[model samples]
Target: MMNYKIFIWMLIVPFVINGQNKISGNHSTQNLTCSTCHSCDIPTKENPCIKVCPRESMIRIDQPVTDAPKIFVINKIRETDIYSPVKFSHLAHAEMSGLAGGCRTCHHYNPPGNVIGCSDCHESSRKRTDISKPDLKGAYHQQCMNCHRAWSGSTDCTVCHELKGKEKSQTSVVSNNKKRIHPEIKTPDKISFAAKTKQGKLVTFYHNEHINLFSLECSDCHSNESCIKCHSTNKTASTKTISEKIKHKKCSSCHNTESNCSSCHSNSEAGGFNHKSVTGFDLSKFHSKLDCARCHTSKSGFKGLNNECKTCHGTWTLENFKHKSTGLVLDETHSELDCENCHKELSYSKPVCEDCHDDKSYPNNLPGKRAK
Candidate 1:
């Protein structure tokens, strides 16, 4: 009877201790099981067994750069240390992050509400029992050093921290960084790459055309890009070791990088994308304002589309079709007529008036007045 009572107490004590570690605030209300955040069912303060930051599944809340403070004086770690608190330029980094992954690049475990700081999750004390995760000081260094090392190729202590005796006051540092902002990123219209391929030497990329004409966001092509790609001190030496697969990874999303090498790579510098010249379908007149996805619905490639108005418009007749929008307002006689009466060919470039009257032709004979 004594041994059985001792066994019951052992089970009850663990339950009581585990109950104390219950999540508070909005997280408590969430319908998440223990498995969502913790790997072990019985998580104690000493061994929480918390999973790594689930970036893919986490609900991230992103705010504009204007909403955040310009500079943050990082004095949380070791207040009595020799080095003064690092004055971090938040606005400048935020603006630069917009080109790639944005806030989620650093704030990996963000929830739905306001963006929380690193100290909220990462333990501040280095002497803490949670050996699995990095402390706040380690977390700060990890995030900053990763990018700085890539671009500058050095992680010297002086790069961020000034000596205690030489450093200015925190107030002065804040005042100086208050007005600091990242410079406007100048986009190139076109860039010509000299490739080592046997088929073609020059590969011209219309940089502005992809952004303005194709309506692609910067993140679409530039996701997961390191600072070294653009800001590397030795660009040639840094990129020389990169694999061919990594080089063509961005282009392979939209283009066939395997077989159609000549399409992008040519002996001479290639010109910008021309709808009329390449696809034989002139988009300059009617389809200039449309997005690329509007016509190219296929997930694969943009090859299957033929030059037919009805293929996209889907059987436009007298009732539903508006001829006035096409720059020609049809007359009473032409308005009553079917689309096939005027547009005999699938191309639908010009009206065929010869079908009704042999003497009549488009532009010369009036079907209707040109829309003002």
Candidate 2:
């Protein structure tokens, strides 16, 4: 009989202890649990339930099922924390997402309804290594930065998180709160300017020069992954030194060799060589119009002859070619037409009546032939 009583007492003692462990609403000191924080229904350890929730739904834990009349009840505070509530800028961050949509990326599955907060996963303190909370400072820094580094944005320490014990005063917070807030606006003037260059060099790059003058787009020199992966101030950084990696790759690769220069800047008169080359066309433009084979096919790419058009055309003597019979010479109108337009099957062939009089006017001198 005593043995039976001992077993019963053992079970009764556990129940009593658990009853004491139940959270009391009167004490506001303790943090709210996963179940208490949200207003949505949840399962206890005794009974577990699962359901597929839509992404848009806001499932709260403790929201009352039935509505009741409310009254204004302000309680007097005994002691309160001095720390000012952080004015979170989730909306500001959302505007800067670029490609990735805002808040959903970092604040992952948390509580009863699986809506999340940083504190849900990264607790303040932990006993076991497997279930340890990220220390307060570490938690805030890591969570804010890891996402920024992954996305195509700045992850500078000074950009977002304020250093520990350096929190702003409540008076400052109040002053800031009173000021009218506005929507996030991009730094428009800096669009053409690269913000931070290598070595604190402050290279004032004109993106408009490459984009408008050279007919290039943002993607021409930069890949999506390249922009995000490069120039990071984090441990997982893949590349550093923007000059060696980004700038050199874009500029020097094509501009380095001499052979490539003469494709449009040849010395031959036949190719329209300019004695006053500087005034005629810049070296950059000369490079733009050149054919690849004109340089690459030559034995030494640099030794290719002048590109002047007169050099080649001068060989075909003007005296050797003329309009026969009537002896009419081509005026400015015909002179500017492409050589192949009238030359037909043979490039040097004499212009026939049909060649110049395709409109049934000239040569025949019919009704429409006379100048109006």
Candidate 3:
């Protein structure tokens, strides 16, 4: 009787395995053998050996929020539930993160691959054995509370979610999202810092121009900032006697804050950054939209680059140069002529036609017919 039963069981097991394989989905189609996350040969309800949290070296990679889902349905927490799934504003958080820490604010330990959700490392069950880290419920609240408390000064549960089925979670989500998110953070045009220094008392920071003209991201200048830094009601701050190096640490990365005291430090509130006035290079038309780092490649010291276009753009010759692209299509005769013939200085600034046509000059005379 035992021998006959064993033979029947062995025959039935193969068909069951075939049936499991028949189902096709992300989980079933995964290359992962059962052993990848489960140690048991045949995992079952009786004694399934499931892996712990963060089963392997977790992969994290930066992805634009545009690629990420705009809203995340966080309904993973199961047990005694008080509220419906929170309709998270994934895109709003991601867009706001650009000025803060980018996607790394929450996905800190993500390995370099697909972007994983918070539940990847944080187990959904709070009763699980992994006590080292917060469970999914705790992780979600923690991340949410950071900004929510800052935004409204309240951690009330209703602020983000609804009581199970009392209100339509979808309607509330749409209403909250449509109402207003973080108001447009107005960058200060000028920030007058009162410096306790003999060289100067006031240092005027050209806040908007740095963002508009220099093309600097808010994070580049204000990295590692917290909500308390801006939203704190207390206007007064504790005094700390910091060194000159410490005082200049943030600005030093882009400006020479050490010896060039006169440049920034003034008895009066100093003027904003002026390209032509300070560096003798007017960036009004050509380089107005460019970041400081574009031309000033050196991160340590923003040393000056040569005024010649060839300094950055390799040597330009008649064959490679496109005269028509300069808003002026060169005439047949001028097209064959060397650039230096008309552009005597060839500084790549306004060309001086007086070299050949002594009477003709740029803007007044046509190098070629006006590019229609």
Model 2 per-residue lDDT tens digits across residues 248-324: 45544334433333332223222232324624423343345554444445543223345543333455434454433
Model 1 sits at a Cα RMSD from the real structure of 4.2
Which stretches of model 1 miss by more than 4 angstroms? Answer: 1-41, 51-67, 108-116, 153-159, 165-172, 239-241, 297-306, 370-372
State the TM-score for model 1: 0.79
TM-score of each: 0.79, 0.28, 0.64
Preferred candidate (lDDT higher): 1 or 3: 1
- Lowest lDDT block of 10, candidate 3: 52-61
How does candidate 3 score on lDDT? 0.73
In model 3, the runs with Cα more than 4 Å from the true position are 1-60, 233-247, 280-301, 307-372
Q: What lDDT score belongs to each candidate, Candidate 1 first?
A: 0.81, 0.42, 0.73
Q: Whose lDDT is higher: candidate 2's or candidate 3's?
A: 3
Alpha-carbon error at 321 in model 2, in Å? 36
Q: Which model is ahead, 1 or 2, in terms of lDDT?
A: 1
Predicted candidate 3 versus true structure: per-residue lDDT over 1-372, tens digit per residue: 999999999999998687645534544544566666666677665555655534334434556678977778778888536777778788778766766666777776664557778887788988988577789889988887886687567778887777866867466677778554667887778888888777688888888887887677788877666565667534453244667777799888777776888787899876777788987878886777777778788766568889877777776778988877667898898888877767756366677777678687778888677776
TM-score order, best first, reads: 1, 3, 2
